[model samples]
Target chain A: MSHNTFPHADHDPRAVRLAARDGTLVGPTAGLAKGFVQVNLVILPEAQANGFLRFCQSNPKPCPLLAVSEPGERGCAALADDLDIARDVPAYCLYRDGRLDQTVHDVSDVWRDDLVTFALGCSFTFEHALIQDGLPVRHIDEGRNVPMYRTSVPLVPAGGFAGHLVVSMRPYRASDAIRAIQITTRFPQTHGAPVHLGDPALIGITDLHSPDYGDAVSMGDDELPVFWACGVTPQQVLMDAGIAFAITHSPGHMLITDIPDSRVALL
Target chain B: MSHNTFPHADHDPRAVRLAARDGTLVGPTAGLAKGFVQVNLVILPEAQANGFLRFCQSNPKPCPLLAVSEPGERGCAALADDLDIARDVPAYCLYRDGRLDQTVHDVSDVWRDDLVTFALGCSFTFEHALIQDGLPVRHIDEGRNVPMYRTSVPLVPAGGFAGHLVVSMRPYRASDAIRAIQITTRFPQTHGAPVHLGDPALIGITDLHSPDYGDAVSMGDDELPVFWACGVTPQQVLMDAGIAFAITHSPGHMLITDIPDSRVALL
Candidate 1:
């Protein structure tokens, strides 16, 4: 599947979402809307939405909830003018009984009145800010997914949503690592700051070369592996919760939102 | 030396300076005027002032020059009104021919016609901000001078001023360390943010306990040692430059200024 390419592409957030809805953008939306916010989609039944909200509040670093819809709601009013919960995402992962069942184009046909949509802010917002500030984003440059690890660090459990924290890693030189911390702190709605840095083992991850999820990018001898609370975390926790049914954006196939990145920056 | 005990002192910046001037506050000014900016005082002959200015500009992290005086001057008008640099500081370290010849209460008697005083932003300003923001500053709590280490990290050399960087250490849990970085970044004039965190060996320090200056603080197994560009760095570099004579505020005995700490915070 062809991903969004830069420079020649229109790179408008709404255009990307429209393409996704029309099935013309059926791949990773990583590079599609460069300066806009993209989100991790989570659609759950109203029975589990309250527990999920509590989980997100307790584990803000990992699951920084951007928007939550009313039961059976289809649009997140703050995200975009006409963002359809079932169709705006590039692709959707339909989970059943704590297992990956099938990947689908859209979920409208299967959507239920009890289904609630959640949009969790993704690291791509801060990553774009970092790049704009001239900081090198290792995974993007390497053309791979940001290496992620399931850490031994436990999340503050909220009811049925309980699990260990998951983190995404990006290696930076010592100074740049400090800088990335500052840059990311501005986007609290999007995971905010790094959860841990330096030694990976401190967070209970053993090997840098062997990430539990996503491709492992090489670390420079002088580079420090900076870890941020990942959006994948909510998915992992929701999975561990043994949810009977759920839907999420597939891997890099995020929901493109009309929200500009800087709007999220804090003073 | 009696440190300023919390909650029962005047704690006014001008009061602190007056006490210093009257020889009543003849010790470290750590807790005095808690919310006002304190500065590292450096007085040098006109011949070396230009070189020192260039050095501070080149090595900003360590020697973030806040105010520079005109030739033959002993005042920093912008730092504090009616500020007589020769007597505002509680204690002065007089360096002659690359050595600490003597420390004095005031430099008024030894003041030269060509002397130019410089006030560099001290880490205390940001440290106060950190503590206000509810982050623990180890040295203050432990009642000791902040641990200063000579590192292998070299400073950008300028005419007649060259030396490896000297860093002050502050240990914090991973999350607090991230907060500390963000807080300190707001005060760029005060050695903005940390130069490095995590392993000391990465910056070429072999032993944490064997610090070149100041008292060492304990590090918890989970705490990361955050290193900031210390004010001592400029004094060290200037000492190595072999100036005929120079005067600096003794460690922790900073110049208490009327400038409010929040005045320096960046938006």
Candidate 2:
């Protein structure tokens, strides 16, 4: 969790992946592997893969699929050169019968041949782009996690996966919000543009300070809360479905990929 | 300005221009030629043309130059194959010594050898794109002119041409505002994306119901007021400087050109 002295903070994606595998880096992967895509990792039995794939397609704003692994395949060649689905992610959350059973650094001991790995696009990519464009991201500036809320906006039902959408909020001045929308629209894979802004109550978020997940950042009097669909929705959906077993990267602890951020940008 | 029974409403750009030139179309040219570029015409003597050109370059959002004519030239071939700048606009505003002298149908009698014409892009181009994308434009839907206000935000001065920026307001729900920003960003030649949103007081506008120019439309309780740098700015600047003599298209009465709307779109 140390932001200052993390040894692998400035390393490349491959090094970051290796460090995670070797147990040297077990913290959030926010600042590591700059300019590379970091993905949310989801592993479930092959029997549930098809249903989840359909769910992702139905809810792209929340769960944009980056790559999918064949059953029992540890590496997703499309996402990385030498990725191990069981160990490359910094932290893993094991769910049993829809409840979080345990949080671990590696899931190698529980790896099964029937497991299918799903790599999903994360907001970190677009955040990097926003910062590069000189737009201030409130959470990053405050050194806190972007606040997330469960909205009344329901996702399209596909198979057994169905749940209300979860969105991450960033506070910005009106002019900055417009520019942020334009900048994020280019990276559709990374949540794209904001789904809603201005009134949090419109989306069923009762209070801005009390987020369902992540820490809430401060909002200025002149700033409005802009919300983007979060990558956490699929995990929430899986939990809601009461799946027998599943594995996912712990929130904010992503799998660094070899793919450059520019590859995913529309223009 | 009968919205239902305009003979040249569905006509081509050339036909609309011909109607204006022949004194058959003396009303506003909002829907005269669909899918064609409409411009704000500014005609001034050669002595002041260089300063105005520099002003346009300094502030692109408010004054996007589409074409410029040679001194005393009656037509700009770059904008249309057959066109007459002095008589093609539906209405002309003759300003004498920084004051509104009179409104006329044509300026052919006043055309001089030392006069220069500047064609600036208008918001009609992007409004077409927004409607095609299924976004509701409040003013367009209510059949009222877009409300414009003079803001405290100053223009980048060039020579003697300088004035506060004028902006057009459109009220939209936060979600639509984001989509509108994305759509307008593609047409930078037509004022581009909004300069401000949410607060009118931040830009020095005190009242939403009473605009400095144009009719105010109703804003829903959930809507945010989005502001764009307006094309009326150049004419306002000319008047503020008290130029000896100048001719400009009257508000809402534009010059229809042969250039298609698609050509001005960035993507």
TM-score of each: 0.93, 0.97
Give the interface-residue alpha carbon RMSD of model 2: 0.8
Which TM-score does chain B of candidate 2 obtain?
A: 0.97
How many residue pairs clash in model 2?
0
Best by DockQ: 2
Docking class of 1: medium
Minimal lDDT window, size 10, model 1 chain B:
B1-10
Candidate 2, residue B71: lDDT: 99
In order, the Cα lDDT scores of the candidates are 0.86, 0.92
On TM-score, the candidate that comes out on top is: 2
- Over all chains combined, what TM-score does candidate 2 have? 0.97
RMSD to the native, candidate 2? Answer: 1.5
